[model samples]
Target: MTSVSIPRRMKGVQIKNFGDAEVLQYKTDLPVGVPGHGEVLVKNEFIGINYVDVYWRRGMMGIPPNGIIGREAEGTVVSTGAGDVNSLKVGDRVVWLAMGGYAEYTIVPASLAYPVPADIKPGVAAAALLQGLFAMSLSHKIVQVKEGNWALVHAAAGGVGLWLCQLLKALGAKTIGTASTAEKMKLAVENGADYVINYEEEKDLVKTIEEVTGGYGVDVVYDGIGKDQTQNNVNVVAKHGTIVTYGAASGFPAPISHATLTAKNIRFVGPAESALMRNIGGGFEKWCAKLFDTIANDKINVVIHDTYSLSEIVRAHKDLEARKTTGKVLAKP
Candidate 1:
């Protein structure tokens, strides 16, 4: 591969102030710095738009003033810093979950970069890297789901939820997924969900869960929709089962009753990427490599709902926030 001089300036979508999607604006002359020690500069080709980005845009999760937005992207290494970061080199195609992947060029620590599999498309890598690893970490490390156990995945049609359903099935667990629409329900079923509930129509989510489990409650509930689904998740868990609350997409906070938890013997687990990384010692990149292998071997299927150009990022965010998108959304640079 031929090495090219890193550009002095790059384009990025900057959010100067917290507001709606319209607040995001294109900045074409942003400084493009060289990779420092133990860092690599990536020339991004595709970036993922997740629900978390929406939170940042809406100021639900405060960002440092003048912070660059976005978390996951796929690109090629344009330059590398000094030290023992030998795995990556200029021209290498890679994917990483970094702080500011919305830009055309961004610097990431060597630890965060992982090689993209030959079989995976750049857009697929961007779409799946962060969410796939999150799902894998939750299922294998956090919940430790075993064979034949039943798991309930909330927001099963969303990016991470869809991946969770597939990963749970691969681990030999029966998955019951919940989506908001019929189209999403169908997608979940096609993606390995044994049972799917359209929460919009099925007001009694707990009853539907019981019916799917043959009167026995699920062994684990991956609640990403938060508030609306959290309590019901706790209620539907079998004795000694675990309830993992990973996301809050329902615009409300999940309420927990201490008395109810004590009576049910249910274990409540919160899987945060930062916390998991701290506990595991090696951080998320190690888990990301394992998931990339799964994707390469066809052990898991990543669902990408749509792709848009970088200029259309606001529209992309609008669709995602509106729940109009079923799976992952990608923005290509």
Candidate 2:
């Protein structure tokens, strides 16, 4: 490793007992962890704030007490432990998908870290990697989206939602996106949603989608809003279409009987993170490469809702939970 000064301690946020944002105790004296074998230590420049972070903080994701939280970050590889790091070297700009990113530095498994392209901004890479890869998986792996397919994307103005809209459009699929507010609906449309529905104003979601699809329901329904929208997904998806319940922004959806899926001959996908992670070792590297190419070629737009200081993480959580953010939320440490 090239010579570079690394601090003994770093600033970070940890939860003593998960409950709310208040439990996130930020401190300047947290120990900077050393990279073990097959690990590389990153000096994070930008950290992505995801709803999954909220789940972890709220005790909904089964995190142990007194642990740091955060899943993804972009930074420079400062040092490497004793193992092959997949060609990673000191000073390489990289983005990693790993836990404990709400800190000045993070120890990431070398396999989970991908080098960032020179033209892509670190913050943009941070904002795009995890969500963009997930959206790509949904588009290409979860359901083979064909041209002319009609897709319904819930929370279409959000980080992953915006990505879904653009990816679907790129695949020649028409999209109907739902948002809670008029502004968000407009953003979704601007991001390539063929039709935008303000769910807050639309009384009958099923009827609205049916009318939009002209009696034939959407070819696929991406329901990230979870509990509040899962049932509506079944009503809006076309026969043999897929319904992907990918997140729990509104809380996990209630259990649905297999008969419910059999009734319509529809496919239901509730992707487990563990199963998703099965691909992370190699699949993510490929996805990130493709995702960045799309972004660089102007096929996808990365929208940042707001960037907050690491100290303002509480406010960040509050705003995200309140649905005040329209796109990706990021933090600088």
Candidate 3:
């Protein structure tokens, strides 16, 4: 276990009010705290910007009234606190999904740190951690996709959706993905989508899905777009098929009518981050380690579209909210 001197102060991005990207402020020379018990101090190289970060920035998800926002980053461990965390030490190159990752330095629980492979860049690792882990966990553990089964992923060319396509393919399930543009549709197909639906072009999403599945419909639909796709899910899911609603990117809650499910004998599962965090007793850290292993072995590939400096975070947020960028967007401090 090598030791390194930790920085006393660092630069960071802070959100003082919930509103637009204008609220994000750059603070230089903020005090950097040492790792407490069972913690490791990370010198961040790159941080992943997610749509949820935008939601947090806008007060949509009920974050603290004024909070530091970010969920994933990759960096090197500079120090460790007093504890008995196994297989982790200073100088380890690691990626994690702990909150407060937008800073130049962050204190992460040793349990949450997982080493990045030599072949994987810090930017790529940062982009992969949260979305890849979520997709892998949902497809493998939550939905339990089986061989020859059909799975539908909404926003399939976006961060988590692209990863879900790969994971479902690896699990032997046939994948169908929905995107808004032709470029995104092509990207989804390149990423292992057996069928790609351009929802903007195809108003009849259910009909296209049914035709692709030979009128039997799919076994599962990973509905990340929420409200916009919820009603159509019933028309596309086979009898006894499961519909997992994980995100609400459509900016509204999905409307559900009891008769729809009752008539089709369908089951709906909600895979919220809180529920997933509860299901994995060892917590997100352990789950991230498993995700890292999969990436190292080429079982999953993380897609990153662009990287911006901390000063350019506002522009990054705008691009993300406008849906102009595909795959993961990242920030380097």
lDDT values for all models: 0.84, 0.89, 0.83
Model 2 lDDT on a 0 to 1 scale: 0.89
Whichever of 1 and 3 has more TM-score, that candidate is: 1
| Model 2 lDDT tens row, 134-195 | 88888988888999999999999999999999999999999999999989999999999999
What are the C-alpha RMSDs, in order, of all predicted structures?
1.9, 1.4, 2.1
TM-score of 2: 0.97
**Number of the top-ranking candidate, with lDDT as the measure:** 2
User: Which segments of model 2 are wrong by more than 4 Å?
Assistant: 64-66, 280-282
Q: Model 3, stretches more than 4 Å misplaced? A: 1-5, 64-66, 281-286
Per-residue alpha-carbon lDDT of model 3 for 1-333, expressed as tens digits? 676776687888888889998898888877787889988888999998998888888888777422678887899888888876446778889887677877898887776778887877558889887788778778877778999999999999999899999988888899999998999999999889999989988978898888888899999999877788888887889998899988777866466678878888988888766457547646776776677788888877678899999878889998887878888999999
What lDDT tens digits, residue by residue, belong to model 1 across residues 231-268?
A: 68877999989999877788554667778788978888
lDDT comparing candidate 3 with the true structure: 0.83
For candidate 3, list the clashing residue pairs, or say none: none
Better of 2 and 3 by TM-score: 2
